[model samples]
Target: MKESSVASTNMAFTDCMTPTELPAEKNGMRMKNWRNRIGLFLKPNLSKHTKNRSHRPSSDDLNQWAQSFDKLLSHKYGKAFFLIFSKSEFCEENIEFWTACEDLKTITSHAKLASKANSMYEEFIRDEAPKEINLDFHTKNAITQSLHDLSASSFLAAQLKVYSLMENNSYPRFIHSDLYRGLCVTSTAEEP
Candidate 1:
């Protein structure tokens, strides 16, 4: 056989053999094989950038809305209801303001509180804001004063007002609407 044919046959045979049997000094092939084996076990199975959706409320949570306003707002279905209800002109800002306040409260870093507070005021409180919420002058002034001190509760009063508005106004309309009624039917059907 030609020299090339003999080399090809040897290459094919070696490729079929296990890495452990290969020489440690052969281009550090043994280390490469061990590293790959270890890497698989060391690497995490989960994606770093994926958001956790486990916070979504169960069907039981939806059924308990009549028990308390707090229960309703905390549930994921409450967010869904608000999103649909906000489709009316001038109504979307209420939900937006409440959501911004919710997000603001999650920030634990002291340095971030001031900046987030300022942005929230600009977007939801200041006159002629792009998405100005229905804040009375008293609530707006309180928020403006709180911005100087900058805490998680800086938007509390305004948030509470909007939350009350939603609870008393949009929420009743939502409960009486077809969308909410459909969700109720679907949730009941899903229960075993």
Candidate 2:
């Protein structure tokens, strides 16, 4: 049997929407602002979640998704972005195909919208803080730990079971909490 690939039949659904053209300086500023906003909202919660070290979960999948999200937003909202939904209207028909596209579409769109909003806010509202302050090393390390913790919380054979569960909607939520929110919020905050 051949390994299954997550490819969407609907090309439109998989495309990402890019933002309007902007000078390099302004574009960098916009991303910084968005990163700040997200960072502020998630830092408090994600920080606590990262302290437990007994767990040692791998972040390969999460990292891949994050990279894909960044690539989409870099377009400046010109192309269509998507997130593959694990369970959706087409779940019964295309199962893997439809779901992957939906989740990717949703995630990419969100990241792009967030970037745009931050860009507009920085231009009109106020300048954001420096980019270096919002590091998520702590959070990422913690989540990696928690993934390992879950297995202890469950049986050995069921080890990879919870891992699969992590792939659903919660993955996005987790990413936002651990990565985007923290990075975005910190960069957007102004220096006192």
Candidate 3:
């Protein structure tokens, strides 16, 4: 596609998104504002800098994402897009911690396991850490205790809690967002 055409399509989608609503707003206006804000923020942002640039999701990928959260997480582009959308919502910690737990599980080194566990705990599970999740007291304490002699599965419960949080919360909002919806809508429009 020509740069001019791409710009116009970008404009069209941009036009459809309503302005972001304020936190004090209610009902229909909030969603309207969210769509508008996200449309602008995500505005044709096919980043040249991303590792997945070579394998950006096709319409098939978007459709697949709509089917299941697991499907979305499994797709590189879908995960990247979802991460971006989550960041916009200021809830990236949930997914970030979830990803950290995943990475932690792959470690064969006891040394690395303890090191990564402490880092993950400080980063997410600890109270008022930079990007905290709301794990229950028991779960948090158990993970904390395990930190002294951590195993790969030490963070499993906490990980599951965060996964359930995302699967039940952000995943639903994401599927219906203008960011996701517009991508699906515009991608189809561009199809032959």
Models 1 onward score TM values of 0.64, 0.20, 0.73
Off by over 4 Å in 1: 1-59, 88-90
Q: Distance from true position, residue 70, model 1, in Å?
A: 1.6
Off by over 4 Å in 3: 1-54
| Model 2 per-residue lDDT tens digits across residues 27-109 | 56654554454343333333434555222212332344465543332332211112222111111112222222233334435
Who wins the lDDT comparison?
A: 3
- Cα lDDT tens digits, model 1, 57-100, are 34576667655667777776677555544543126777878888
TM-score of 2: 0.20
Prediction-by-prediction clash tally: 0, 51, 4
lDDT of each: 0.64, 0.31, 0.73
| TM-score leader | 3
Flag regions of model 2 displaced more than 4 Å. Answer: 1-21, 40-58, 64-192
